[model samples]
Structures are given as C-alpha cells and as structure tokens.
Target: MKIDDNFYMKLAIDEAWKFQLLTYPNPAVGCVVVKAGKLLAIEAHKEAGLSHAEVNALKTAFLTQEPNSLLKVLEKSSEIHDFLIKNHNGFFEDCEIYTTLEPCNHHGKTPSCAKLLSILKPKRLIIGLIDTNKIASGGIKTLESENIDVTTKVLEKECENLLLPFKSWQNKTSIFFKMAQTLNGSIDGQISSQRAKLYVHTLRDKIDLLMIGGNSVRVDKPILDTRYVKGREPDVFIYSKNKAFSQAIPLFKVPNRKVIISDDLFKLLDYKFVMVEGVYTLLDILKDKLDFVVLIISPKIRNGVNSVNELNIDFEILHENYLGDEKIVFLKRRA
Candidate 1:
C-alpha cells in the first residue's frame, strides 16, 4: 500500500489502542516519526511513569542515528528530554511526528513532551485531539511558538474514542458495558469464541474495577479475573442488593482481590475505569451512566438467550472492529 499521512496516523492509532488497558490512569497515545517518507520510529505508551509514545519514538529514532554510542539516563522522561534537546539539533528538523493525542506541556513525573518537541524541532506535529486536561493542554501553543507546523483533528472521532478512558479518569469514571451474543441474538450459552472470552480477560488485567450483575454470578458462578492474559486482575464490584452470594463461587475465594457488594453505581465514580458485563436488566439500570458498549458478535445462533434483543434503547455505533471469529462493535447511547 502506498503510504500517506493518513496511513501513518492510522498506524499510530492501532499501536495506541493495543495498550489502552495497559496504561491505567494514563491515555494510551501512539506516535510515529516520519522523515522524507520513511518511518523512523513508532511507539505507544505501555504503562504509566514510563516514556510516553512521542518520547519513546524519539528515543528509538535517535538510537538509529547513534547506534554505537549509549545515551545515558535516556529512559527517564526528564533525561530523555534533555538528551534529545542537546543531541537533536538538525536530526529531526525536517521530520514529522503523528500522535494520537496532543503533546503534553506539563512537568510532572516527567518533562513536558511539548517542551521536548519544541527543542527537537520536528517539522510538523499531527495531533488527533487537544488535551482537555488543564495540566497538559497548551502543547499546541508551545510548538506553534517555536515555528513548528501543527495539525489538529486528524481522525478526531477515533482519537476521541481512544482518549475516552483517560478523559473519564479526569472527569468521571468510564464504564464500558460488554455483552457477547450470537448472530441471531442468543447469549444464553457460550456463543462467543474462546478467543473473545480471552480478550475480555485480557482487558480485565488493566481495568480498575469490574461490575457484574448478581443474576450472572448466581447462574454462571464465574471467576471474572484476568487469568487468561497473565496480568493484574481488577477489583470486583458486584451489583447485587442482597449479600447472600455463594461462598462456593470462585470469585469469592480469590486471595487479595477486593470484592465490594453494592447496588449503588455511584460508588463507581470514584474509580478511574470500570467494566460491566451483564444482560438487559443490568444494561437498563446503567443505561444513563454507560460511556461505551462492546457488542461481541458471535457466528453461531444459539436459542438460549440474547442481550441485544433485550436492549430497549437506541445506541450509536462509535467504532466496529473484528477480533478473532467475532466482530467487536463499540457503541454508546443515542439518547
């Protein structure tokens, strides 16, 4: 495929999305540095307190220029900033960086990405969305003042979707309601593929909280941890009014995992990110509070039960992507 700015930005988004769960309390941002139509480096934020996407990309790209010599203290964000500023006099003068979110301008935990970019002097900075957080929003101005070209709102909607978790953490806790159903709308049995099931578990590793309905727990007696991905499991939030849950349930026996039983969804606001997996009644109860929905489309048509058929409200499909043999549709309320 012939490469263009759009293609590069799309690649950045793909890279960023992979780590959305991994970077808890931090936005999963991706960056790609292109020089003379050649890809210099591509990177995404893997976790908090580590090098951000832009800094990581710059570090990797810089290494290609100086492979024989080691740059000391470059892994830390502040050190990376100072190193790049001192070394990248004209190395990135004509290069362009495509990023999924605005470069940060604040100095906390690390040096400001905007300040580093200003010093490195990239030819252009293509941004998806301006940072809404007050602490990191003025990066565009800083870059512009340094005479670097800047572009905003490239793939804005998709970038907004990518930033949803981060924004939620800043304002209110983000809740994504997930449901797996057959093509004909049956979810009674396991219609979703094993891969899809594992994918859900992988997400479980990164989230702060998991909210499951009482009925599903009673009937399924499931363990909703992130064992499949070998990552840290999230705290469990049970949405049952009654405290008479089963002691035999594996979820209750998990060591060191905090399990809170309550019907009030208000408690979730205190969390950064929360995942809810339930059928219609659960969805209806959280209809007004939900920020996103994952409708797992299974190929099989079982007749046991279905969550989509039970949905009573209209939804807006934010984005749709396939996973394994299933189609993952991300949606929000039309209301």
Candidate 2:
C-alpha cells in the first residue's frame, strides 16, 4: 500500500488523540518520522513539561537508525534534544516529518523545536496546523529560512479540532461533559468497558477539577479518583442546592482532595480544565456552559431508563473511536 501525506498526518492526529486532555496546559501533539516511505517513529506529547512530540519522534527515529547510540535513559526533553543534536549523524537528513502542530520557535520549558529541526535538516516537514500561539507561531518561517522543504495544512480541520480543548483553556475555563450509556441509551449502571473507564480515569488525572451532580455522589457513593491509573486525584465540585449529605460518601472521604459542595455553577469557572460527569439533570442545567461532550457508548442494548428522553439536544460529533467494544465520541453542541 502506497502511503500519502494525508495517511501519515491522519496517523499523527489519531496518536495525539490518545493523549488528549491528558496534556493539560499543553497542546496534545503527535509526530511521525518517515524516511524513503519506510515507517520510522510515531509519537505524541504525553504531558506538560515533558519531551514534545517532535523531540520524542526524532529521538525514536535516531535510535532506529543507530541502535547502539547512547540516546537511551535520557528522559528529560532538554537531555534528549541535546543528545540528538550532538549525535544525529544525518539520520533524519532524508526523512519527511509529519506533525499535528507547528514546531515551537521560541524556547520555554524545552528548547526550540524549529531550531533543532533546522540543525537536523530533515528533507521535508509537513504540518497539520500552524501554531496560533504568538510565541510559537514563527516555526514555519524558521523552517523555511533553513531551506527545509515545508508543507502546511495537511488534514487541517482534523488537526484544528484536536486543539479545541487547548485553545479553550487558554482563553477561559474548558468544561466538557462526560457520560457513558448503553446502545439503548440507558445511563444507569456501569456502561463503559474497562478500557473506556481507564480513559476517563486518565482524564481525571489531568483535569484541575471534576464536577458532578450531588445526586450522583449520594447514590453511587463512588470513589471518584484516578485510582485505576495510579494518577493524581482531581478536586471535586458537587453542584447541588441541598448541601446536606452524609459524610460517609466515598468521594468526600478521599484524602488530600477537596470536595466542594455548592449550588453555584460559577465556581466551575475558577478552574482551567473541568470534566463534568453526569446525565440529563446536570446536562440540561449545564448545556449552555459546556464546551464539549464525551460519550462512551457500550455495544450492548438493554431495557432501562435512558437520558435521551429526559432532554432534547443536538451535538456535532467532533471525533469518535473505539475502546474495546465501546465507541467513544467527542461532540460539540450545535448552535
């Protein structure tokens, strides 16, 4: 099968989606390195203050070309970048690089990716979306100046969609609703696969706060932490008019986590990234304020009460993929 630029770019986009929202305060990004139409490395930015997608891809590519090189064991972004710059040995000189976002031109936590690419002298650089950030926007120009063949806007819309959460949080609070339902649309019981549930746990690990209806807390009596992923626990905000609840609720008992109970929704605005896990009641109330919705739909159909009949809403599907037998969808409310 002959692979085109779109094929590689799409792969990069999908790889980035795996780490979506997990890279809070940092745009989730993916990169692919291809030399002579042979596969090399596909990597994504996994977290804030970590090696970027480009660096990770290039490092992996270098190792593929020079297996015995001393690139291993270097975990920090700066360390990997420095090692690659010193020992690249023209490994990427004939390669084509695909990235979902433009390389950063300005140095922040990590060194300038554009500067490194210029030195590595990759034959061509394909970008899905230009960096909208003022500080990082000059990468294309930098690459062009270095005479590295550059292509832009490969799968532009899909790449742009990937950045929605990052952009929303940069300007204001980004509140996305998350819920799981069966094929029949029933919201009751556990509807997500273990993989789907793990995804939710990873999101919870990255978010600044997790909001849910007070009724959910009281009834489920759940331990709403990232225990499955062994990740950081997010603070919880319980939205309810009646703040009177038994102290025995599992969520309220989690150590080192603040469980805020209030009727005010404005408190959600205080956090940059917030995930709301609830059904019709909370969704209806938060419809106007939500930036997106994450639906985990199980493959099974059964007789049970569903949220579909409790509220009427239309959302445009932004992205969808499978987690085992479940179909996870990202949607935006239609205007």
* Best-fitting candidate, scored by lDDT: 2
lDDT of each: 0.83, 0.89
In candidate 2, the residue pairs with backbone N, CA or C atoms under 3 Å apart (3 or more residues apart, or in different chains) clash, namely none
Q: Per-residue lDDT of 47-144 in model 2, one digit per residue for the tens?
A: 99999999999988888877877787788999998998888888888899999999999998999999999999999999999998987779989999
RMSD of each: 2.9, 1.7
How does model 1 fare in lDDT?
0.83
Indicate the TM-score of model 1: 0.87
Could you give candidate 1's per-residue lDDT for residues 54-123 as a string of tens digits?
Answer: 9999888877778754564457877777777877869998798999999999987788899989988888
Best by TM-score: 2
> The CA-based lDDT of model 2 is what?
0.89
